[model samples]
Target: MAKIILNRENLFHNLNLISKQAKGIEKVAIVLKDNAYGHGLLEIAKLASEYGIKKAVVRTHEEALKINNFFEDVLILADVENSTYSHTFHIAVNSLEQIKKLPINTKVHLKIDSGMHRNGINKKQLKEAIIGICEQNLKFTGLFTHYRCADELSTDFYWQRSNFEQIKQEVKSTCEKLSIPTPKFHSANSSALFRVKDFDEDFARVGIATYGYLETDTIFNNPKLKPVMSFWAQKISTREIKKGQRIGYGGSYFAKKDMTVSTYDVGYGDGFLRLNEKHKYITPKGYKILGRVSMDNLSINSQDEEVCIFDDVRQLAKIHDTITYEIITTLNPNIKKEII
Candidate 1:
């Protein structure tokens, strides 16, 4: 059977690195949405609690409920509907309509659309959103924005930051005028937390970096992060095939010469992909996957008793032409997760 091995030491190292990067910030909210980036929610939540992390971010009320007791605050980045759970979670108000719908006195983080245009109220609607939050008696706890190009080498980040700065000033001034206490402001995400020197905000909401999947050249060049998860599977069977013998569905691969192949207990159903011949995946020891990945099994050109699928998701992301977050989060949560 295939299983995930989590290195607690490596996770601690990455958390420590994040703390160092967030030295000047008032708080560091670990983004645990997507099941802690597929590292296991309860497990990583326990670790974060033990590490003295006081804040966390999730995508839904259910996710926040799972780890609500672990942190002083759990901010829900999405699903801002009024519900019984609204009182327990700090909801993110991404639009003026959402602000109006929130229950009275519900805690919220005002999301200003600096430039992402994916979420948050537009800059033009900032005043209306703030007024709605105030009129509805919602407790404005924080103000924030998302960066669309913080991971890339582009000037768009600067423009977004400038717009957020303007939003910050407006939020503060408007709160003061309405006799409401100013909320804490934050904008830097995982990439901006490291790349932006002016990230002296109330908190840094870090996600990918905590899970060891940084994508920026600036962070990668420094190399302080360590991947925490390693995937492995045991060889279930082995066989030798003659030259020209076809393998797997569609005869996608043929044995060039008499060679050994071992079947392992992991496949696309386990969150792995059936790569085509042109993008054959390799094992840690450089043995190639022989053919199409089955739902619950895959064949590899190796006879080892066990095999390491991957220790870092970046390699898998590269082959899949996607991001590391997608690769790691796709890992089936049903697989056994062992913390070492």
Candidate 2:
């Protein structure tokens, strides 16, 4: 079976950098959604807790429940639970309709659409949403927006930030007039955090950057965010092939010269990308993947007992013409993962 090696040192290092950028460890809310971006939910959560991370953000309420003990505050980006409410869990209210459905006394974070338009209520509905929260006796505790182009090279990020700033002022005034407590406001993501010359948000929800990957343009001079997870596969078998011998499905690869090749216990079924002939990928150690990637295995030009498939996903992402998030998050959750 394949395995994942998580570098504890790198994880801590990334967190340290993020903490400083956020101004303090308490202000850095680790985004643990999607099983910690497929680095393993509980695994990353445990490490974050060890490193003094007090807050977390997840996509679902159930995920928050899984790591409730790891952080002081768990913010659910979506979904809601009406049966019970705890101060530990804060649900993001994406729309006015969602605000109406939350249970009484539920801690809610009103997500302002600002500009993303993917989720959250529009600025026009901000006052109405707050009134709905108050009417339902829900606890309004946070005001946040997502930066759609924060990771891209565009002026849209500034526009979005300006929109959020205005939204914050309106929210403050309305909340004060209605005797509603001031909600914690945050909008910067990983890219936005680095883009800001001065870190001043209540807290930043950091994800990819915390996992040792950043997709910003060259202008940011991104920090040294070391990749925390390295995917490895054990050698299932090895063979000496003659020159011109084809390998794997459809015999897509033909040996130019006689060489040793080994099959590794990982493939698309394990959430490893099914790389084809055109997108040649070489391992960090210089082993080349040969032939078509199979569902349960792949052939590599190496004889090592265990091979590091990838330590940094950015290199792999380039081959796939995708982002590092997809490369890492697509990893099989059932694969054995251990902290190094």
Enumerate residue pairs that collide in model 2: none
Positional deviation of 149 in candidate 2, in angstroms?
1.0
Cα error of candidate 2 at position 282, Å? 0.9
Compared with the true structure, model 1 gives a TM-score of: 0.94
* Runs off by more than 4 Å, candidate 2: none
Residue 188 CA displacement from its true place in model 2, Å: 0.9
What would the TM-scores of all predictions be? Answer: 0.94, 0.98
lDDT of model 1, residue 242: 91
**CA error at residue 100 for candidate 1, angstroms:** 2.3
The local distance difference test score of model 2 is 0.91
Kindly provide the TM-score of model 2 when superposed on the true structure, using C-alpha atoms. Answer: 0.98
Per-residue C-alpha lDDT of model 2 across residues 1-340, encoded as one tens digit per residue:
6899999999999999999888899899999999999999999999999999999999987898899989999999867566675679899988888877777888988898989889889988889999999999999999999999998889999999999999999998998899879999999889999989888879999999999999998777799999999999999999999999999999999999999999999999999999967988999899999999999999999999999999998878988999999999998889998999
Candidate 1 per-residue lDDT, tens place, 1-340, comes to 7998889999888888888888832378999998888889988999988888888999988899899889888899888457756345789988777877877888989888888989888888877887788789889889999999988888898899999888899888888888888998988888888886545788999999888878886633454789989999889999998999998999888888999888999999988866766776777778888888888998988888889988877777878899999888998988888899
Residue 170's lDDT within candidate 1 is: 87
